[model samples]
Target: MMGQFDKNALPVAIIGGGPVGLAAAAHLIKKGEKFIVLEAGESVGSSILEWGHVQMFSPWQYNIDQAAKELLENAGWTSPDEEALPTGRELVEKYLLPLSNLPEIKEQIMLQAKVVRVAKKAHDKLKTGKRDTVPFQLYVEANGDTTVIEAKAVIDSSGTWTNPNPMLSNGIWTNAERQLHNEIHYGIPNVVQLENRYQNKTTLVIGSGHSAINALLGLATLQQKYSDTKIYWVLRKKQIHEVYGGQENDGLAARGELGIRIQQLVESGRINILTPFHINGVYPTNDKITVVGELNGEEFTIGDIDEMVVSTGFRPDTSFLNEVRINLDSTVESIDTLAPLIDPNTLLG
Candidate 1:
């Protein structure tokens, strides 16, 4: 539902530089619309680089957006193997890099510009009449200076990658958890690159997803090099078998193998499994962080863990959009139609 506006007089403002934001830019350009892409990082696709070592489950054919592919193809760019699954590194280096380099897109992207606040020009949420007529004002802090920019409309594609869920079952972050920030890691870490950091340490992994499984796999590899290291996986589910999805039957070999490997690790005693567990709080012990939780409503404490990794999944940051009128599903935090099926994992956060 795009509004009719004069592109020359008031350009459309795009909020992120990731794949989705870039694809929107391609579409706007195809429609001969004037727009600006504001990226809050040093460069486009900065977030993708964080997990560059991880490979995607989807192949190249499913990864590229139609408009973006067309734009890249028209500019004499050759496509990669359509059926080959790409690692995050290869996706950024081979695809995103070339698309960003295109003159049409390159000229519109603004890096290191973070938008702090946004509202209708000279009007607050209370105002109605002529509010649509007045251009939207975006408060952007770039290079340590705050500046206001006007846009006919804004497309806030700021992704959910950066905002990770907390370890607590309630998801209400506490002071104790904040104090142990240095010990707790989120998302996938380049375990191979940080050999010294993870060597000979007991790490606790929370969640029953692919990410948690991958972290365990990485730690298992680390344990091979340094036999003293250990991995503990915690899940709130009634049964550990719930996480074993598709296995060898899955079309994606790597994904299927992930479940099989994790299953093997759990049975082989390489990774300690604690299921039907609910975390109440995270406290710091003398040498390690102590995880206080309940085992299926029975109080229990998991102590002396040197490190913790949370892979409970993602949630979008929409604090700045409070004044804007938009529809978002309360449960999934996504558009209503696309809301994910009731999470298969019984762990509620």
Candidate 2:
């Protein structure tokens, strides 16, 4: 039985204090609705700081939310150049941080709070009687202790940045790869800052996304300083050109420039590219990793790799929402209704 109280008095709960979560808060403020934001990191946009070195293809104008911008403007905040590209760090410094500091939002945010579970109060997944009348119970972990908070509604804007896809082509995690964690970097690495780890070394970068391209470009810069540095790129696409999105035709010039630059780099032959490669296994040999895979339908082994940057991609984590009934696409794992519109196969082709 649920306790009797004013359900309407409960505030809306927003998860993840990144851009989206903060934006939701701004919108709610505009609607005169009460809300609380729970952030897993020490501060807002903490995840963005991880890849702060990489610049985004989109500009500030496209990234800022209307409500957030309105709030910032009222608070005497100066906007960055609308057309200029901003690195992950710049995005946080110029936009996210400013928006989060607004008096209306700052006090409502709970930092270092991680939401571990969420469910309807006094009701399990199978229970439906009076469920709509009750509030949502969120189990949050922070400061080595767990606390339960109730909310009239919940917004899961927790992005997929922290949950990256595995390196194996078939999407499997093995002990061999786990043991070589020290030598393998999952996401983009700040090659310039961590020069010693990659300088004068042979590095393998997997995937054809923007992150992989960025990693290779950084390595290319290092190769200039240290002539012995070697770079290898691997992609599952049959032809390398497939990964070169719209190129010059893209609406966003910055994004198109990426395709142009990468194509030129590939033409230069400074980096080795292996396409249609399916990684079957990774093993350690003599303190180095040997990547066994099928390249062009033939079994092959790539050995003597000092480091690996796996920019494969990421997937959303919905484990906490197990008690909440929701529909997700089986393949894309996105909202059922949104899968058709956002599916990569539909958009890429």
Candidate 3:
């Protein structure tokens, strides 16, 4: 249920209920400040819930925050004891939920409320020249109705963990084919669908990141059971070992093993490893997909691919903040740290 606000009750409004936003709420609560957190999804940690099946590389110690840890420990919340990394679901249910259930934090969050617009309130004409407190108007839609909230400051921790960048390819591929191939299904937690589709046929995986490695490994696992399937890993670099940089020794080892396995597949002629090349476009050829590319100044085409997995990374979601007067970095899609400076007291950008 939506609660009635007195318009001047809360000094700050937070958009998003992820870890960063929740941590900000904890800080605000500790300082005895009134604030509200608006979450567009059914619960906090909506992105975590979406990737529930995928295990995070970071351990609990790295993932949980000091504020959350203190709150949960004080409440006698038992943390998961598994030495192995926790899946997204486990992190949400065990960490986020427990932290959000704290009395101080729970009351501050409003779930399923989407913030559509944020605008600065116009000061009176006479008061324009004077230094006055700037009010932020937040337009929110919740439960089929529109609501407005005004706050002295706003913090946006709505990162791009929820939005993923689609595969960047030449425009030769049809929209239907892209959807069917799952090329646009960026940041999908599982690769079973792609594995199944490429069964008994050649699959081309492009990229040098962990995503590409994971997809290739999954496809190789499937090929071991299914006799007719084949895999080809294509990278712009000269070798696969260039992408195996991970902080954890085990992580590095696991990635190295995948690289070695790919090499072994190439040696055994089970999988083809194409290096120093880039895909130009995808053309439909009757029932198969043909990938055309360039290698060492010579143009080549790899045909009869049943599926293609592109592991291109994502950029942050900052388009909505363009009109908010927050300075952004020119080279990268991120908020500028120095300009349109954040207030140390309010932490508002």
Residue by residue across 99-214, what tens digits does model 2's lDDT show? 88889999999999999999998889999988888889999999999999999999999998988888899999899988988998888999999999999999999998999999
Reference-based lDDT, each prediction: 0.86, 0.92, 0.69
Candidate 2 lDDT at 61 equals 91
Residue 157, candidate 3: alpha-carbon lDDT: 82
Give the top-scoring candidate (lDDT). Answer: 2
Top candidate on TM-score is 2
C-alpha positional error of residue 4 in candidate 1 after TM-score superposition, expressed in Å: 14
Each candidate structure's TM-score, on Cα atoms with residue i matched to residue i, is 0.94, 0.97, 0.77
Per-residue lDDT tens digits for candidate 1, residues 38-101, read: 8898878888888889988888998898999999999999999998989988888888889888
Pairs clashing within candidate 1: none
lDDT of 1 at 199: 96
C-alpha root-mean-square deviation, candidate 3: 6.7
Ranking of predictions according to lDDT? 2, 1, 3
Q: In model 2, where do residues sit more than 4 Å from their true spots?
A: none
Q: What is the lDDT of residue 68 in candidate 3?
A: 67
RMSD list, candidates in order? 3.1, 1.3, 6.7
Error at 75, model 1, angstroms: 1.3
